[model samples]
Target: MTTFTVPPVLEARAPAEARGVARDGVRLMVSRGTAVSHHRFTDLPGLLDPGDLLVVNNSATLPAAIETIDGVRVHVSTEQPDGTWLVEPRDFDAARPGLRLRVPSGSLTLLRPFTSRLWVAAADVPGGRVEYLTRHGRPIRYSYTDRDWPISTYQNAYATVPGSAEMPSAGRPLTGAVLSALAGRGVLVAPLTLHTGVASAEVDEPPYPEWFRVPSSTASLIGHVRRSGGRVIAVGTTVVRALETGTPEGWTDVVIGPDHPIRYVDGLLTGLHEPRASHLKMLTAVAGEEALRASYESALRERYLWHEFGDVHLLLR
Candidate 1:
């Protein structure tokens, strides 16, 4: 796996707005092959050709982090077909089967381990999970973040479907103005839904399955773009997964890496991933290992920020 040590100071502690930068003013690192260039995110529309298509994720961020009455932090990942929720209890050392944590309108009972870190638990949340979360949950935060941020700070401006535990952050920097510019520049844009699970993958672990939908309209548009010799640029890793999977609606567990064949996507716009993150493997599959490594080195040397609220990277063919 391609890896590098990210300095602690490079971690973004807050949203760009809180750091005195406009949401669209965050730094953007563009890599075409092995050459790297720096620019603000607002410059995005001009970076691509007129016929290029930008595919974005419309899955919204959820206030998935809730504190139990006993003060245990639980991150709600996904709800299974059987109606049980997959969750992560942060620092709750005594976590075990039958342990129940009380929430505002619900109680979570640990049933078994879903993964090494996640638990498949039965949650009794009244009035639906979205309604319950809106009233009682906060956005998930890690040790790197300084404090809690509002749900708005964790959402893409165009998100309409509420399901993801964390933000599909690559699209976060595309403000209303940038969208307009892309349209004016004659760049086509489309949306797909991919409700992301908690981004708490253990080192070298593959991403867990999450619900996704590639609308027939979007899939047809992709075929149209490819036939016209236009590039299909996925706005985030979620979009890549959904577009490549070609599934109309269902759970996806596909993992793209260096050896994986790239069929639908020709470019990618995304955030800087942590060292050894499986996301990096998708980056490699899209941009090649040499380009991926050189881009990360440039990002680190230039001191660009990291994490969901930080700078963005554009990898193109």
Candidate 2:
């Protein structure tokens, strides 16, 4: 058995805040079948065919981390079918089914435990989810982050739906100029919605159910692209989850691994992820195990960055 490991030096600590280098100035690692190459993100427009379709996640990031009177930080994962929210209790209190946290902007009450660290709860905010989060919430941060960044810093260039707790970070480096460049080359871009949940789980833990929607138009486009010999390039893993097994609108618990063969996605444009992370399993499905191993080894040897705010990797088969 092989164990994947991400070294400590590769963890990206903060968003790109450098001058003279646009956020997209990060390096790009491209793997085509068994061949690997390196380039800058600005060169992405020249890498693919004009007929290729770039499927993007239009879901935006939300300010989901909040604190309470008792100082327990609540991380909102997503909304449930019952109109309540799924959240994680940062600092465990003696909270039970009826426990309520009186926040600065509103009140959040625990309904039950969804998981060991998560709770199903309701919010009685002054206005609504958006307004409440706007007034009191901050972007969810892991221990790797130095400080809280503004919600805008976590947003994608083409974000339209405000639902995801975290950013669909693969598209973060895509500015309007890059989009125009791709368009000028006859490449097409389409949108879908996948509201990503919390990432506080262990790396190999199977992902929880997440809401996704693939419109009829996008579905038809995918079919046409396949028939016309064009590739379907997913911008992020969230997009891969949505387009692969998603219906018009529903929840997805689909976990792509090396054992499962991919059907629709041809190339993947994504941020460098942690080693041994569940996402690597999906990458193995796209690139064979040996090829994936080679790409990561090359990335490590070349000192490419890692994490949501790090460099990008393009796996094209």
Candidate 3:
């Protein structure tokens, strides 16, 4: 995949709302073939046709980052089929098997390395997983964020099924007003559930298997939309991953890129990705190299914000 260095200035250090901008007030960059245009996220309703189906991931954000007694931050990624959890000890490199980290009312013992960056751990929390996280965990924060924000700050207004390790932030700009506007404009909206695991920022790794469910209703709606000659506009790459999996529900590790075939989606609405990020490959599959390159160049030149709390990109056929 082609890549470029992301200037530090373009990184969004705080949520738009904290920066005195409404969540839906972020910039929107549109890429169609080789042409690029810009608009505010609120103008999304006016940008699409009536018959288009906007598919959104309804997976909610998990307050997955918990601090140990020694101040080590642990990111709970997902629950494995064997009932153990996948976790990453942020900035703590000396971790090994049998290492136990104590939290507020729970303890996590690393069983083994799940990957180079994550570990398979046994979580012993008194209450349930959801209850414990609600009481003790905060949303995972990266270095780019200026300070700690509440879990609410990391959530999408439409999110309901809580499971994602991090916020599926491309949908963050989709506020109630935008939904109502899209509905009023006769644009269709559907939902799928994909519990995203920990995002790999340090490695050029392919996506890990994450549990996903495409409801029968959503599957049928997608078929109807396509047969009616309407477009399936995935609100985020997570949505594309779920839809293209072509299954009702299960763990999906499918990696999309230039060589990968895109069978279900026609367009995408997402955030600006980092250079060399695996997501760029999926974007290339949707927008093609020429348009994708053009869009990124325009985004950098226009100073569109990057990251979960940043600007958005819309790629259309």
What is candidate 3's CA lDDT for residue 186?
Answer: 90
Give every collision pair in model 2.
none
Two-way lDDT contest, 2 vs 3, winner: 3
Q: How would you encode candidate 1's per-residue C-alpha lDDT over 1-317 as one tens digit per residue?
A: 45589999999999999999999999999999999999999999999889899999999998999999889999999989898999999997898999999987679999999888899999887866677777888998888999988889988979999989889999999889999999999999999999988885426678988899999898999999999999999999998888777678999988988888989999999999988688998999999999998999999999999999899999997
lDDT at residue 29 of model 3 (Cα atoms): 97
In the range 40-132, model 2's lDDT, one tens digit per residue, is 998999998989999999999989888988788888888887778888888686879999988886788999988777788988878766667
Return the clash pairs for model 1, or none. none
CA error at residue 315 for candidate 1, angstroms = 0.4
Model 1 TM-score, 2 decimals: 0.98
Instruction: For each candidate in turn, give its C-alpha RMSD to the true structure in angstroms.
Output: 1.1, 1.9, 1.2
Candidate 3 has an lDDT of 0.91
Error of 3 at 232 (Å): 0.2
Clashes by residue pair, model 3: none
- Which prediction has more favorable TM-score, 2 or 3? 3
Q: What is the C-alpha lDDT of each candidate?
A: 0.91, 0.85, 0.91
Badly placed stretches (over 4 Å) of model 2 are 93-96, 200-202
Residue-pair clashes, model 2:
0
The reply for model 3, stretches above 4 Å from the true place, is: none
lDDT of candidate 1? Answer: 0.91
lDDT digits (tens) for residues 211-246 of candidate 3: 999989989999999999999999999999998888
